[model samples]
Target chain A: MVNRCLITPARTLLTQTINPSLRNGFPAMTEARVLVLDADPLPRLDRLGARARVLHTDEKSLAERLPEADVLLVWDFTSDAVREAWPGPGGRPVWVHTASAGVDRLLFPELLESDAVLTNARGVFDQPIAEYVAGLVLAMAKDFRGSWELQRQHRWQHRETFKVHGSRAVVVGSGPIGRRIGLLLGAMGVRVDLVGRRERTGDPDFGRVHATGALPDLLPEASWVVCAAPLTPETHGMFDARAFALMRPEAHFINIGRGQHVVEDDVVEALQERRIAGAALDVFAQEPLQDSSRLWDAPNLMISPHMSGDTFGWRDDLAEQFLDNFDRWYAGEPLFNVVDKKLGYVPDH
Target chain B: MVNRCLITPARTLLTQTINPSLRNGFPAMTEARVLVLDADPLPRLDRLGARARVLHTDEKSLAERLPEADVLLVWDFTSDAVREAWPGPGGRPVWVHTASAGVDRLLFPELLESDAVLTNARGVFDQPIAEYVAGLVLAMAKDFRGSWELQRQHRWQHRETFKVHGSRAVVVGSGPIGRRIGLLLGAMGVRVDLVGRRERTGDPDFGRVHATGALPDLLPEASWVVCAAPLTPETHGMFDARAFALMRPEAHFINIGRGQHVVEDDVVEALQERRIAGAALDVFAQEPLQDSSRLWDAPNLMISPHMSGDTFGWRDDLAEQFLDNFDRWYAGEPLFNVVDKKLGYVPDH
Candidate 1:
């Protein structure tokens, strides 16, 4: 997800209530009703001011509001509330857009069958998530957590760490985010094998993009196995006990993708039994994982909340991207980052 | 250190005693006596067997053995025994080499004035240290420490972290190590300003290597300030309070160079005052940095036991490197990493 760092007047005008139609390029989107599924510290959609009748709703009110809206903005991408409160296929908005890259949460049977077009905030998160993955890889390889622990004890113990250079990594996602991760890791001297939905050759970035089925063969050879795949039926629970068994004892595992992509119990068991070197999870099966969960006690495991793609000023970037797409929608132009409801992600073309 | 992952026969023959002279391309040098300043688990110099009389000595026995040895291999590079036991200009080994990058420990006035040639393991540590520094930069930018802390408390907290890409780094030290660091960071999309003792232009890696005098101007703009400079009178205590004060509040300071380059107390004060965002020190003025040292409690300060360049198999690499240089010394070929004693480093060619 590589968002253009747009330098637009809306960045400054976000907090203000201004008639956006007077702006140079934006035409009024009159007669359209926009329904926002709200979260705390609501998004600055003032950029769409006086152009459409914007309505805000929570999980409780979303179903009733769905029938009247012309456009549905899933601002609270974390919620599965939309799925639970979704109106029937016939009453839904004409267009549905999620403020996130993954459309997994929104892919209910009704929504998938609905005529409403699906789009997502895809490009905004690519680079940030890639940087985060690289950081995790380095942290695990260098034993930074061990260093911090040693520092806490005021002990100066020297340990020989693993080198990131010349190491092999299998990145299980050939999307923009995974591609960026491969590029950054490659920059650090890592040999990256990117895995896509299907086998592809002569990729501009990765010379050979292996298919998902090739993971079993690739797992044993990699020093790192990263999960960045979209959460589709075929991808869900792809990294289970068998997958962990195939990995070398020295290899590390990292997941910045949807939690469903990994079997949490198997990873926890792998760490406890020392089957793998270590693991870093930025996403879990249940985000804000319950405090009583066994994951907190998993040995040699690093757990970070699902904030990999959210860097400082990320909200501003997301907002800008949404507005840009909104402008295209208003002009009767085809939108960017349209997710294929059946596929659960924008097909890599 | 960037030790070559050598696949020589010696790697397997290391533990066994063998007459190395029978090996291809190696000539016997029975006249030379080599003294190894030893540490626990002595280096496998079996490759030197029967060629030179090898003697292992510790700090107490070093001065007594100095007169008998023709060559001094400072295997225990951390020890200051050489400086304390040096027999002065009248009686000294013809050549001295440290199995480490910095020659600060061996740069005593007597040795500098003597005819003995000093060489260091220069190329070995360059790539490893660069990788370590890059790791530290990514770790700090992504707030890995904070994530670890939250994970420890079973807290699922999401925080926006800084992006490493598009950040500026001021790397002080235009040597191989610094150059490599700049290259790796540049690969991560960071703009690097490499500062050297003297200004240089059109450097094959870094186009314009700024002089040390430009540091103050560069400091305020950098998100990271890295010290990889060799320790010399001119560079000693260079990163003091003034340097920290000049840095942006968001900037992180990293020291992979000699501890003397930084005034420890000044850094302690800066960290305590929250003048800088964070810091990571792999070297301290007095290491195994005393248990009572205030650095341990310094907020956001990451401390390690001077192991930045020490990756797994580093010792073997160092041993092999020393033996490689030994081959040149025995052949009477000019040494590869001959240090300019007056400058206290291998001058950049």
Candidate 2:
């Protein structure tokens, strides 16, 4: 026999946040108080605010308030508070959502084993990140840094630059973001090889996604080695000294994925030794990278704060996504973008 | 008369230069004396060496030798010697070719009115320029300078960025490069309006290419205004104060075409006044832009020494293109990429 579930009137924010275009489900649903761990002001959640109580907090106050909130909105995905505080319960929330695609920080054993459902802002960042990656490819191939340096010195030096067309790129990931990247690169006449965790076929974006086993063979042939994979036990430190040694000397590396997906020390060493042509990293193992990090001194490396996928209206997109999911949950429907807790990411299929 | 024209064995370079893929048309054609005005070493013409007497000259000695040449190859595309020396009483060659897309420097009245047919390296630079312009757009939107500056200081600062998708763009030349830029930008989801000299329809890349007359209406709505028009009597200084004024204050301007297309003083003024957000210029009114130029200090302005379309091995591509056209000329066939003398550019059709 199936049991009927009911939330108190105070938790309706969960119901209202779902796509408003979706039929209102479970009328008179409880209005749960939402604890928002914010780094900065999020896009105003007018519809959700009208339906539920949202208590804004920060990394400092997140732990103290975790027990009182009925729901947790990890708006400040960069914080580790959720992992640190989840075990301390007044029981954890029934569901947890992060305004980020990577959930490495929220994958602690306790939460992974918990009954809580996890969701992330996925679709919103995919296209933007793909666009960013495309830009990175062109920027590197065109020697934009050299151009910028010349401009700085008021120098007018004309030099030969490499072209982006007909080049080979191996994108490491088979998720929507990775596929979108491949699609955009392919649109520009680049031959793209997409690598995923397992062998796959029949993908429209990547006709036949290669498995991780193919990486060794693929690396040497790629002029562009892009890391867009999630940070999991298998992926963490995958791009190490050995991986760098496998790449062609002229190949460039770009990371729009988790920093842990690459070994920081190894990347630095390779860059310093010129093991690879260059690297453009938008994510780092330790963000707001330590002021003394030697990676800054590595020749031909470009470091960007983790804003590869955050475009002008990104916050709004994140908020809207959450609302849509909330609506589905309110209607007693399964949530979209649900993460496979054991795998540490949402399975593409 | 279908009579075979004989070329003296000494001038074989002129006939041998044609693409051998042309079935060795008009066998034993006239070996015409070929004059190359070069600032740098011209590509070694191995095949042509046996068929033509190649004469290499620099700007200093160009006039002295122009009268005796049967054909002219302006390998020093940047020099004005061709235009300045064309009027000297010595007869001009039947055909002249410049290793560049822009022929402004060679558009003197004497050459245009003469029987000389002109050709240029058109297709080679199209894709490269398109890629460069796309890079510039991303660079400006991503605030690459700020990121570079922060990287220099080993400081990590994350800031919000505008999205490329959904933003509107106005690309001011509907030539191959401009259309390719529009195509790539469109692939990234940006709405682009391509402007040409006249209204055109049914372009596979851009459904409708707007005419210059649409600028007044389109500029104000554009967030990115790109100038890729060639320099001509009708185009010189076209982007003046009035053009800048018509654009949105948040707009960014990119000039990958001839620098003379924009009025330097007006651009600097607009940048200083924050009339437009920023600009990236790969070309200038005077190249090797005078180090003392005030534009160096203009806020939100990026400058490069006119190398947008040149990629590695570009010299080879130019040589090959020239040789292909020469083959057609050798066979008395119509040449490709013939610039309309009256219009100062190759007509799109």
Candidate 3:
């Protein structure tokens, strides 16, 4: 018999064994090994371990043991140890999966050049982001903060607020997050204009979707402008003083994308001048925004610690997604959500 | 020619006439008796005097001339004078339309009993209320106020947030405003449970609706419970201490309905106790909430000065609704949005 290997069907093994060569002619009783990196509780890996030989290690041990593994599941979202440590002396794992949507944290030149497949947690964040955008739009329109203040004082003041219907909105970025945001708003009767990288067909009820170049025209008409695009060279610092100036004096802005996409100083300036009505920001240019930043005092602005796409049970959704992908991989079927190293997505585009 | 009256339309009519009937019908007529509520510079109405009788009234003269008018278009919402002073002793005007919703300020028993027909601005407010609800949801979910404080201090903390999807919401009222709220949230993937007065078929999305009695069971499951119901004997103070106590600690309460529906002291107590997570109130038991009231200081509370449904150009939509009704009445067509006097709405039920 050919030295055939039958990888114990762990979630990770199932994901890696999708290659026809790996599945059909293997040493029949030999188990494939998987390395799970940087998981604290390691329940998901433990569950996989029941079916296969799973080795779990933190950053301290990963570099030493990575070469023996057939698959690697990168669970540590905060560290790029996988990129720096992967592609060992002989040959690397056939596949790698990240527990996050953005793999910029894990991208390495070597990983990009290698034939190893890459996948990410994609669909998990879409609805949450869309919901977050809706919430921001409502908070600004209804003056929720003001209401909370009144409740503290037992004061009831009747003030006029703006309505969403007949209002125009511009959702920047055409990714799943942005598209979902548009769908939610469009259903509310607000005329939504979705600005994507380029136009595509069969999109539902979008009032108008233009390229980034059309933002100048779209901005002036928008009562609410949402930023849900990714953080890329093209999107970094895309919202600045000029962008704010283009918006209506009554318009409100919301950012659920990467923080670096906005020029923080310009946002503060525009708000201080009362040029735009208000804004809700979930991401900042810097993490753990320094305590000394002046954005806190910017008038009409609502800030949230970046929590828009992070929700309860989110981890479970990511785990489930990985398991489904693993099943597809083991069956030699085309994998879903495979990331294109260059565009950084499976590129539904 | 039936009295042979000639009514000449004013040149400024294009700007002031929001009612389609007035725009299309009055302008084409060369001879019809017209009474313009001429106040101030009155040039717009003065031009009409050339071919028809124009009644110039200050605050004092309106009561005396009201009976002779064939129709009364209440453009001024500030005047409660019409409710108090209109002479219904003789045959009242054939029609009365207010350029506002909630005819509470204008409705009198005499007007109800007279041959005069009444219509109010209803549909104008539906979308605005819906938008307001969306804002409240977002503000609470995203911790917008907290974020704002952090932003003011230039502190960025990336925290996890509760998502609107897979969450349950209950909209207490089944009117256009409440239905619109349900629809908006539903679009965001929230499982919306609309509670109306009673169970009925053919209602929009009635599958999700429950009766008022089901509120106790629904409260515990709802992440958001919105109050858009009208104020009635049964509904007054419905959200009492017990109701608040029933809500989950993670739930948020929003009141866009009349303030009298909520027990202010009880709501404060609930928030203080953390029995329910938070609340956003736009309407209050008293208007211009007293500065000394303790509600302003309530923990996890959001207060808006009752401005949710009010928006720019909202008055125009209200005006158009009335004008459409006027045309229907003159043309012997059944009127739309006729008030149910007892129920305070046209009996869509």
Scored by DockQ, the top model is 1
Candidate 2 TM-score over all chains jointly: 0.92
lDDT of 2 by residue, A292-341 (tens): 78778788889999999988878888888888776666545667787888
Q: Which runs in model 2 stand beyond 4 Å of their true positions?
A: A1-26, A60-64, A87-90, B1-26, B87-90
Q: What is the lDDT, from 0 to 100, of the residue B261 in candidate 2? A: 94
Task: List clashing residue pairs in candidate 1.
Answer: A1-A123, A1-A126, A2-A123, A3-A123, B1-B309, B2-B124
Off by over 4 Å in 3: A1-33, A37-43, A52-62, A87-91, A146-159, A202-209, A213-221, A240-251, A269-277, A330-333, B1-88, B91-95, B105-111, B152-157, B207-221, B327-334
Candidate 3 lDDT tens digits, A19-96: 335444443333556677866545364444333477787887877778777667787765658866775445577778
Q: Score the docking of each candidate (DockQ).
A: 0.74, 0.65, 0.53
Residue A249 in candidate 2 has what lDDT? 93
Error of 2 at B287 (Å): 1.8
True contacts kept of each: 0.85, 0.72, 0.95
Ranking by TM-score: 1, 2, 3
RMSD of each: 6.3, 5.5, 7.1
Error in Å for residue A20 of model 1? 24
lDDT rank order? 1, 2, 3
